[model samples]
Target: MDYTIEIATTDFITTESAVKGGADRIELCSAISEGGLTPSMGHIRKCREMFDLPIFPIIRPRSGDFLYTDEEFDLMMSDVKLCKELGCNGVVIGFLLNDGMIDKVRIETVVRAAYPMEVTFHRAFDRCKDPFIALEELIEAGCQRILTSGQQIKATDGLDLIKQLIEAAGDRIIIMPGSGLNPANIKYVAEATGAREFHGALRSSAESKMEFMLPSFAAIGDYINPAIKENDVREFKKALML
Candidate 1:
């Protein structure tokens, strides 16, 4: 199975380390603690200079709801275009219908904006009302890949369903299993589902980038909570080695 790491933050130094540690590709974003948001142009540009691996950016504008207004849709399109200009290999994005189906019109609009670059339908797939029905919409929309958790919390817990999706998708689109994937469980997920790709933050909660030294500082300083940790990747890979 192919191992993929997602660096959902603006830290270039840590992002580079992920590239060096045998990562096949990266999904770039920010604020993973809030389930990720679209990263800045400067962060994307910096990572582009640091790594030649495929850097597929997460095109989520905010973390809350997937249903977006026309204006929000416009913003997503603009960001998709920017990612293409910044040399991203592909983009990870998704939009859902009010009834929890794939929003075909919006899908076409973003896929069209991405143009020559690939589009990965992200975890929003798990939210769909029916996996089988959603599969048709994703394929019809010309999505290159779909990152799903087998409609569960992790691939291991949903391995049987994941296998079914993999078989059903066939060669039409990639079924990349994401969410709660770590080194220890990668082998089982790969074996059970025959999935070729995995996605994880590889986070180990390393010390905060900033610390609060004062007692009166009730605001609890340190704006960035997701400190970058290389060991998370290292240990993850090590577990996979077994």
Candidate 2:
């Protein structure tokens, strides 16, 4: 019953708000709308200065698939080193083969580079051909946790498999359900999966305060920036309490 909620934060504002609203930890990233990419070094440093909670920055080099080229893999290792230099508590990472299996060699190398810091294999596990086999591979690679939606688009839709994964994981690894969680279904997920950790964004949008709205021009890709609302984070935590 003593579960923890980790907020997926994109910037300093969301980081502060999530901590204020009682987020136990933070998964810092950029471009969350595109499934989260590695955040800037300045963002990681600023968050370390601003909060006392554990920070785990995503180590993905790009937005598309978990498969990476040798150069991309090198960039990811450098990012992991940078996260450690910034005093981040951990890093979230995942890599796969073209055949849809865990990239064991590359993953082990990355985890070794991360060193004493905790590492959670990200949703790339969902892309694997077999969840059970990938689960064992992650454990062998020394990951502390796996953030997954049971290989489905949403965790709720994969509740049965999530429960099975939790049961299979036992004390060997932590299985944290993420993707598409909200206040309404968090309780159900907790009860059904018996998981001790959960991850969510709990984000809402607010329009920019620019006086002159560009009727014909779009400066940024998005009109309304997505941010983590304190109330929504609080509500998600409250649901876990219940």
Winner by lDDT:
2
lDDT of 2 by residue, 1-242 (tens): 58889999888888888999999999998988889999999999999988998999999988999989989988889999999888899999999999999999998998888988899999999889999999999999999999999889999998888899899989999999999999999999999989989999887777876777776654563467677889898999899888
User: TM-scores for all candidates?
Assistant: 0.89, 0.96
Best by TM-score: 2
Tell me how candidate 2 scores on lDDT.
0.91
CA-lDDT, candidates in order: 0.79, 0.91
| TM-score attained by model 1 | 0.89
Candidate 2 off by > 4 Å: 218-223
- Residue lDDT tens for model 1, 132-209: 888888888888998988888776777887899999999998898888877778767777888877787776444454
* Candidate 2 lDDT for residue 152: 92
Each model's total of backbone clashes: 0, 0
